[model samples]
Target: MSGHQMPATESVWDYPRPPALLRETRRITVECGGDVVADTTKALKILETSHPPVFYVPPDDVRTDLLRAAPRRSWCEWKGSAEYWDVVVGTDIRPLAAWSYPAPRPPYELLIGHVAFYAGRVDRCTVGGCTVLPQEGDFYGGWITPEVKGPFKGGGHTHGW
Candidate 1:
């Protein structure tokens, strides 16, 4: 798939291959099951080629009491193994709604204490003051904001990308 950068917008194609982990001060928030699960102005974003940025919030900023350890785990070539967390609010439970790399590979080790959520799995997620859109598939947890343009890689048939 092809994509073009627009004025005032960033093209996912312009992002790096190994992915750049950058800190952001914009307000990022996540809500689910009628409760605010996470809220933070200090966040880390993972910008990779052909995908929107994935915002990772520090564990201290999240409501840890509301998160339960999940049984699911996954491996990433760049970040190493990841552990999942389920968001629990009263009787509502979102299974494996968030993930983090407890022991990431080099360059990604900075992500140690941060957690990234799946926008589609959560009730809502916002960057700055704008709501976010989940990257086009279930596999990738990229958050699509207005300033990021995409012909993103998460959709069907993009596995070979």
Candidate 2:
């Protein structure tokens, strides 16, 4: 779909406006500066239209010490305002590398404290053993795995779409 390689897969267009959260049992790992910052088998994947799933890992599974809350905040109509976190691993500091919905809406209450990392900003982000490709824009934090085919919304030529 769009310009991306399309395999027999779920179309991002079919996703819902309020988004859907699915429990992911696959191994999700986020590594940065040669250190595994977050790894878990219990993650929640948020699915939205024109975007790949954004994996949200539980705070308990993540190395909390590595994340520092940033000053910036943004609003999401469906989820609520989001707060950013910088992933600092030794000398490597990825600014605003992750985000979470502090007080999400009723439908997304499960994401209250869950964190989702930017796949491209981190050294490596993998799902089910396959490295993921970050969604093509700075705003959206979708993780594009090989198993997911997308005409993702973000990056070039999609501003008006």
Candidate 3:
């Protein structure tokens, strides 16, 4: 746990902060088929890591129609505004991959809209049960769910991490 070291202009929190799952956290879950979208009971955060802990839900629970809004954008001056996602798994495509921030920036503003996923473009990246392995540079696939246990860094196949 050590990655929120922001200090180029100084800005980390002013409000909206409540997520750090670790007390079982309802065993965690993020489904896309049987709905259930993302469940953790309440807020869940673990922002201090080498990478593998980002469960900031609260965008209406997130089922957002299998996510389909990827005009492509990236920027994180310490968690502010960022949008992405193209995970339409019923047919199979995997675009933008997944990203979320909505309007963060008040110490993260509770992740504004909340939404993070890259476990390699999402398709089947479980954790605790073991089933990661991909992250290297291809659009990220790290930090899935279950209990965090596997390999997910960027994905594999060669594209444009």
Best by lDDT: 1
Q: Per-residue CA lDDT of candidate 2, range 1-161, in tens?
A: 47855445687889887799899999999999989999999999999988899999999989989999999899988898999999999889999999999899878899977999999889999998889999998999999886677788998888986
Q: Rate the local accuracy (lDDT) of all candidates.
A: 0.92, 0.91, 0.54
Candidate 3 lDDT over residue span 1-161, tens digit each: 79855323211122123423332343334654444455445545544332345555566766777889989877755665588878675776578766887776656565666676665555443433345443466543345433444333334533331
lDDT of 2: 0.91
User: After best superposition, candidate 2 residue 29: deviation in angstroms?
Assistant: 0.4
Error of 2 at 151 (Å): 0.9
Question: What is the TM-score of candidate 3?
Answer: 0.27
> What's the lDDT for residue 72 in model 3?
85
Residue runs of model 2 more than 4 Å from their true location after superposition: 1-8
- Taking the tens digit of each residue's C-alpha lDDT, what string does model 1 give over 1-161? 55965438899999998999999999999999999999999899999999899999998999989889999999988999999999999999999899999999999888998999999999999998789999988778999998899899998879888
